[model samples]
Target: MGGQDRESDAWVYVVNSGVLLDDAFASLTLKRKLERGRVSPENLPPSIVGRVAKADGPTVEAALEAAAAAAPVWGAYPLETRLDKVGELLCRRLTERAEEITRILVAEGHPVVLARWQVSGMLECFGPESLGFYRSQMHQEFRHGERRIQVRRCPDGVVCVNPPQNAPLSSALLGVTSIMAGNALVVRAPRSAPLGVMYVLHEVVRPVLEEVGAPPGTLNVVCGDPVPLLSAWVESPHVDDIMYFGSSENGVRFQERCLTAGKKPILELAGNDVVVVWKDADPELAAEALTESFYGSGQLCMIPNQVVVHPDIADALIASLVRQVGHIRPGRPEEEDVLLTPVLRNEKFFGCLRDALDKGAELACGGHAMQADESRDTAGIFLEPTVVVVRGLEGARDIDAVRHETFFPLLPLIVAERAPDEVLLERFVAYVNSNEYGLRNSVWATSSTVVDTFLSQVRSGGLLKINDSHIGFLPYLPTHGGTGLTGGVFGEANYPILRTSHLQGVSISPGSRPREAVFGAWNALLPTKVPTAFPTTFPTKRSQEF
Candidate 1:
């Protein structure tokens, strides 16, 4: 999904008490602009942007209350039963409604192909087989000679889901797995990209939720200013967990609130992912991986924000990247041929590019802003796919381009001038780790030793892709979350089904040995033992006797 212009509408959806309510007391206006640079009014669609009604505090509270009331019943249900019945049905609905959802995404400025891909990904994640790993992770049985212990995980009582504005459908789709783990959820539709997410939840998933005999309040969707809704969830005593996806600035603050309220927060915050290219790495492959920086206009959390390359291959890698970038076409997101979307922040893009260049970095290619024309004419939304090269670390680290994350299509490449040595490797690794945001990082190297060192030494992102694309979402593996600023306090790969729950240890004592042991320990602690029917053999030898 992408940003769009906002227009007012009368539609309001609040899923509460197992029903979809249309009580929109307050409203939020969002925009969806198709043509950039003040497109001729005649060419634009009549209603590209629209507004969504907001849920009041009491309404949100009611939703949470209902969810709390239903949590026990849902949480007690069998995991496999929920996955097979609810998950499978939701997956089918997503597939059936894929085209409709894709159309909505396209209308919101997502590319036709990319929109389809997004829906496809959502389907994959919703598929029954996708959550099979959590079955074993959530439940385990063990036994010894005399003791039988069953170590299993149970869902957090109630989860309040606040997915990111970008890719809301896929992100909120994670709540399904939470349900599969037997937890009730209240998912907030993305304020910016609610159309697709709303369609999936209301049209596809809601029906199955009701049909499967999922208790009322098991699932709720509220649309409004996130501040109040989140506060309500935090204040609610019954809410057990909050899954948040957004910037570190807001996320850190929310995490604090969650901690203060004694609620678990599963955060998927910002990422300034880094990529390292060793001297022996394939320039073409490195370029391919780094090119992902342009994906989603570089707005993605997993996009490669910075590249650290050996000087020997830095020039070659830059050349390959420039060549690859030349093929990128910026146009309407609904077009099949367009690879780059209009950048939302033109000033920030140019400002970052200017700062990098002023700091002794060279613009390898496509750094300047492009003028709007008939074919490509989106103002403030279209930036040339840019690649900036920093020959050394002197002025690079202080520059905003390298130091901070700009959600624009800009890739900053830093050159390690020194040869590969323990000292240089250590310095480079430190540099990569210095990035405050850690979501995912990668190393492009042919040498097993270099790869191993990079893996073992670089302690940055939650995920380390040896040679894979930095932005691809591998559903089977953990894709969201990271360390440092990416996830607060508790940072790791976010597996919602597992992370939204806690482990519970159950021990079954087959004999009365435990009772006897407790009695003996109590008797030893007490000077006078009450009359209890328990046989205790005195030790044959004591220290004094010996």
Candidate 2:
């Protein structure tokens, strides 16, 4: 279904609630450049990937209107019913079409493995563990004799999503969680490459929405210039929240706009993640895990941006990492093992490499442009997976490659100066937390003490991995998001279903006067017996003293 056998002018459907509308593609008016490939997609071979309809600002307004109309009815469904009906079905759809969707992601310039990884994350997000956690986080009931008190989450009325072009389908997965929140969703697909996201909404999400007899406007998809759509949403009263994805700097500004408009801003911004390798770590295994830095040419926010190695084993780790990187060469995106993709404009990559070199960093390996076949070529479409070794924690972040988030295949290995293990560990923790951006922090260590030290002391990133793949996603763990610059204001471990909703405390009492309920409810408490609904551990009416 994701293949290019269809005509070049593939039409992307605009779904309003559960109804599919054709001609969502603007005819004759405009068909933008293919957005499938990374960097400058226009520079690549004329792709079989189809053109997107650049819907106008008015279309975005209409989509928002439809979502606003549908949200109340959708949100009224019992949370359990919504999870069982829509969430359950979406999992099945993803499982059935995993291969096809993977291909579409590859076609959109993601490496094959990254594509599969994204698919796996989607499955895990809807897995049994995550669903159970969602139930706990979304709703809880308490009973005291005839009175019932409930604390539950309510869907934000209408959610507007603007997923980054780098990984639209994965980012748009946030919108699916919005659906579970009982919020109606509107997604603005990236105009550069709208095909993958367009495909997912129809084949995966829309059918489930329809099967459940959801409001026709429960979910909507539009592809166009982001400027118009974003401006329209910020000004529109219908948008309750805008899930904007972009650079951290821009996202911080967008956050202000959302606050001014009384709209919640759920941002998935830039990430400068970190990994720590203690002296006791396995060199080969550590090198293998560090390869995640090269995935998607290091474009993704979750990839390990920098690695801090204990000075005692720094040299060995660097050697192993250089060998591992030699195998991660440039090739076609569809290649089973290809990790490198084209970097159409590598000025920033070279600039960072040069700046680090000038500042006394040693080039470990790979700081050049290369052809698809891994041959050195200045004009090649791809850049080698570059690694540089920056010594000492003192002024380590002064280098751009270490300080800023990189969108290319540039990884810096920071080796702190040798010191006593205790002092070194404290310094490492301090250095890690000093990072302005925090999306993830992974540690590779054999000592339980060392791992525990990092776990207890280090306070950076939204998620952490210990002796596991840094970029791998797991059920019950937050799959995306973080703190500091990565998530702008109001940032934490972001679970879309939770982040997009608000909690309300509800209590229902029968045969009670208003004054008694408000002023003397505790004084008029019933017998000191736990309700039948609650188990033995549940609390019962009693004196204030334990």
CA RMSD of each candidate after superposition = 8.2, 8.7
| Cα lDDT, model 2, residue 492 | 84
lDDT, candidates in the order shown:
0.74, 0.81
Task: List the candidate 2 regions with Cα displacement exceeding 4 Å.
Answer: 1-47, 512-546
For candidate 2, which ten residues in a row score worst on lDDT? 15-24
> For model 1, how does the per-residue alpha-carbon lDDT over 1-546 read when each residue is reduced to its tens digit?
001112323243211110100111111111212112233333322343433545666667777888888889888777666666776787788788788887777766576766776776676676545656666687888874466778888888899889887678778887667887888888888666676666676677767877877887887777767888888889989899999988899899989999999999899998888899988888998898888888777877888999988888888999899998876666666567766665545887877788888888888887665642324334434677888888876567788888777888889999976754666677778887887988888989888878888878887778889888776656566767798899888988777888888899987767756544556545656738653435455566784386
Which sections of candidate 1 miss by over 4 Å?
Answer: 1-53, 127-129, 371-380, 515-546
lDDT by residue (tens digit), candidate 2, 407-482: 8999999999988999999988898889899899999999999999999988778998999999888988997788
Query: For this target, which candidate reaches the highest TM-score against the unseen true structure?
Result: 2
Evaluate candidate 2 by giving its C-alpha RMSD to the native, one decimal: 8.7
TM-score of each: 0.84, 0.87
Residue 397: error of model 2 in Å? 1.0
What local lDDT does model 1 show for residue 272? 86
